[model samples]
Target chain A: MPLGLNSPQIVLLGVNHNTAPVEVRERLSLSGSNTPALRLFAELPSCEEVVFLSTCNRVEVLVSTNRLDEIRESITKLWLDRGKMDSNTLQGALYEYHGTSAIRHLFRVASSLDSMVVGEPQILGQLKDAYRMASEAKTAGLVLNRLLHKAFSVAKRIRTETRIASHAVSISYAAVELAKKIFGDLTGKNGMLIGAGEMAELAAQHLIAGGADKLVVANRTLSRAVELSRSLGGSAISLEEVGDALVDADIVISSTGAPGIILSKDQVKRIMRPRRHRLLFFIDIAVPRDIDPKVNDIDNVYLYDIDDLKGVIEFNKAEREKEASKADRMVEAEVIKFMAWMESLNVVPVIQHLQEKAEAVRQKEILRSHKVIESLNDEQQKAMDVLTRSIVQKILHDPIVYIKKGAQKKNSEMILDAACSLFGIDGLEDTQKLQDKCLSDANQDKTIRKPSPN
Target chain B: MHKFLFQITVFIYFVSTVGFLVHIITLRKDAERIATVVLSVGFGFHTAAVLMRWFVGGHPPLVNLHDSLSFLAWAMVGSFLLFQWRCKLKSLGAFVIPFAMIIMTASSFQSKEILPLPPVLKSIWLPIHAIICLFADAVFALAFCIAIMYLLQERQIKKKRLGAVFQRLPSLETLDAMNERCLTVGFPLLTLGIVTGSIWAEKAWGSYWSWDPKETWSLITWFIYAALFHQRLTVGWRGRKAAIMTIIGFAVLVFTFLGVSLLLSGAHSYATWLK
Candidate 1:
């Protein structure tokens, strides 16, 4: 008596990388704002089963909707309240999807196909957490339950089958990717980290992992320098000591938020004089860039900026793309299979009724035949009854085959109604009457478990 | 037949060189293809002309500098044609055909008349010196092409000019592999040529180490190439540094082939095209 998976209609509203900046995403961050939103959603008569996914690159609210217009408006108002602007203010930046499009969009988002980095796996987990929070608040229902479960399964299929999620996820990883392509491995090489900034720290960590020795971190502040030394397990040197440190530094990464060039062209030239022209890897990650752009003119010097790293980043992105395509194909296949299962759901009750009626017929026919066989003997009558039951089962087999075929090709409901009319069958009416109660009981506040092996 | 074929071969070479130079300045592949076709025509005629000279002169064409240079260049054209057939390496011939044409044209300036040699040139070393040196020189000429490509490719990569020509050029790793393969094959052949030349020197000059201008320059060219070979295998040298060194080696090769004959006075004066 499960209430047929009657979802309110599906609706999707979101802002993504192209429409919103980091600042906009930070303002609408779901970090501490879910409580009031959940209460408001429950208060809305038409809204049910909400899954809110909020990440740095995307902000989306997917919810069940019996009233599509009211839900789309309500979701847009939430954006308006957060931005303190008119609902139409975000019109240019916002995208809305309904029905099957909403389902497909959510599958894409949860699968990371829509991610800025594309193929990154965090969004799926974020999506799962969002669904879990909704279920806890008693917002999710039968349609939502099945949809979330399918979304998770589709995401899992995509990750396993596609190349989208096949690459490094962090800044340090991208840096290492670039270095590995440049010099296969940095074993036996000495590297210097300048300015203990966040970007420099990340690059240094990757270089050390790549088998390079962290010779020193040259910084302006000594106490902050000592912290970097203890943290990185490398020596700390004063900013004045950078020039002295240049000769032995094979790979120099600088990320100070300096106003101008920290390592000038003249200093690198002076350094070249003493080093007998050894190879130099100058990585600048400052906003204005720490190293001079002209330093690339030096022979044997390989200088790379954030923009230069973009090419390598794009390569990593391409790797993700290849994996994503595989994942997409996998998702497509699973979606087809899931759709088939959904269609099968349609005729399940009719098939169940047909099965019940067949059993009743076998039981009645066997009882009648037993009475007729009383003339034979006690053991012979039982044998005759068994033969009668077998015959009834065989007689019902062809109709059962046609019913199953009808379930697959035509609508299950249509096939079931036709079969009921033909057989003059009128049982299981109680099941149709108890749809809401069954749906509520079936959902019963249980979380849809994610369907991938840990 | 030999004379007429040689005229046709020289004509094709001249036209193809003009075609390539114009095409390169225009940045047109259509023009380049036309140039390549002309070069192929030249090669066919050049091959026939050499075979005819062999039939008419009654010996192999490697008897003297003039015939040896022409015949070797024809073999180089064959090598290039075979390379193009196997791989999409026609872009290479745009640089190479001009070189082959230069050698052929330079040989043309020298007499094509058959002349009997003195006792020194009359020895069995005549064919041995001509064949080994010329064929090995052809391989080195190919190596020279790869080296220049290596340098240009490196510059384009460093400058981040990823244009059609840049893309059309083989990958840096691929060019390095090709350069290494060519050097490896050419180096040993050159070594053999030097060894045979030393033996010939001993028989002709009564001393193998007299340091004739051509001999001295040949040894210098040999030393440069040997250094390049050693550095690549042992020192792991390649890319820009290796490319520059290769350019330097080619300069010395020019000096050995042209320098001793053109500017410096030497016993190998008969090998000069200036005569």
Candidate 2:
């Protein structure tokens, strides 16, 4: 069946880390458990399907609608009303991608290429959750089903082929990486978090995730330290016991807000003496680093300050950016595949029309021959039917193949024109006015492949 | 015929070296495959040349400096290909294969005549000692190359100016692993080489403890590597420091292998320049 000029068009409009600040994004964000995707589907007139993706970094609404610009405006207004903000205030925060670019954007998002920390694995899971929500709400139809599944495969390919997600791109992650470089593995290793601050806690989380089982949280405030330790399921220690903790710690992350140094070079040297120069990694992410800078001069004591961690993160970011170019090529190749499939959709209707016209003519001729032959029995009738059907199929075979190949190349205009004129099919050329619909759809599509059939 | 084959091997190594160099420069994908295949063919011909020399002379060709140099180059190429296959580190070729080319080029300048083997060189332990030492040397050469790459990558990471070379090179973790792997394999072979050479020395010279310059320098190189491995095991000396120490150890070993025999007189001084 040939889709008319009103085939479902893809429209994407939302706020991302790049397009909006966290404050603005939070105002418009949808919770995963209670997404208003189905409500959004009901609210919009022309929208056929909707999938809303809301994460800590981005909030995107992907919809299939025949009215692209109208739905885009409606979505922007929806965000403004939902945010309770003025139009001008929320105007620049929302970015829109339509048709194929919208799909490419979705692919990039699912692959984590569009993430704040590119190649972080969480976005794929988050996208999957959003997809599941849309599926449950029945707001995702055939177009979205194919697009999302294709996106998942693209994400998987990007993850496997490139080292985008293999390296750490955050300060806490860099601390874990340095620990690996020092200890080779963190299993059963001891880690100390000095200060129980947010940064210290984050580093501690990364360490635990990387298999450092033994953790000690130390801070000047004993109660806060104890609280943090209880939350993280680790033992708590007072700031005074940091030296004692340092002796057993293979990885130490200190992010205390204190102005002076927490561990002096002499204290570190003393700790080293007992351990006989065991490796101790210190990540001082505080503004004024907790550990003395000279502590790095001590044997087996590796100290990396915030700036050093930043350097690691920056290097990793550059590496991911390089990998993104490779991902871009893969996405481009996939888009070509998808566009070819879509162009093949155009050929489907023409093939159906040509088949219909041929069948109609075959039926009319058989009836006329049946009336002229009075002695034709049932056996002879069966043979004549087969003979006529085989001739029609043979005549239609070459033209069908030629039309399909031309359609896949998107050179369907000349071939469709020639085929329609040769076959004397009437409604298709008038439906060529409906080519305006296909033309507009193709315009919204990046690889339009034609100007006009007329 | 053997000499002609040897020359062709050297020529092929030169071409392979150029191909790898272009791979690093252009970042072309097929260059590594082409270069590796070419280098393997060269290694095959070099092997043929060695076997032909062995059959014609009625002995293994480890008699003099000329023969030893060619053998060392052949060992380096063979081990390089082996490691390259094992690790899939084609970029390492850009750093290591040049040593084989340089050794073969230097070998070409030396005497090619099949001289009579000295009575001292006739011991079976001579070939064993030489083979183990050359194998160890080949591994150390790869370690040196990886160490160089590690330092370059580390500098780029530290300076926060990751550019073309940094992208072409492997990660710090990968380079460090290669260095560690080489040390793990090379150190034991070096121990065996030293042990075999000492037994041979005891038989030939009546004393195994003579501190000839080559013997003294080889011990020095051995101790340097030993200390490097010890620090890595106990104190976790790795990354930039580890890389730097490997490079230093390679330099000392090169001096022990070539400089001692060429520039300093020793009981094992058979590798003097051709005259």
Screening candidate 1 with a backbone cut-off below 3 angstroms (N, C-alpha, C), the clashing residue pairs are: A8-A65, A9-A65, A49-A139, A162-A323, A162-A326, A162-A327, A163-A323, A163-A324, A164-A323, A164-A324
- Model 1 RMSD in Å is 12.0
Best by lDDT: 2
Q: For residues A1-454, what per-residue lDDT tens digits would candidate 2 score against the true structure?
A: 3434455677777777776778887887733325464576546887788888888988888888776548866877677766666786567666777666777778888888888778999999999998998898888888888889999999999998887887788788777876775565688889888888897888888888889888899888999988999888899999899887788888888888899887899998987756755567788888887888887776456688898888777878888888888998898788667656655666677788889989999999877776755478888888888998999999999999998888777566777778888998877777755754655554565421211111
RMSD of each: 12.0, 5.5
Q: Per-residue lDDT for A350-390 in model 1, tens only?
A: 66666677778777766676657668888987787788677
Tens digit of per-residue lDDT, candidate 1, span B1-275:
88779878988888988887777565567787888798888888888998888787766666656786787788678777766666554357767778898888877876788765555665677667767777767877877887787677656546644333553455554566667777887789888888888888889888777787878888898999999999887756766676778778878887777667778987867644322
- The deviation in Å at residue A348 for candidate 2 is 1.2
> What's the lDDT of the predicted structure labeled candidate 1?
0.71
Candidate 2: give the clashing pairs: none
Cα lDDT, model 1, residue B245: 80
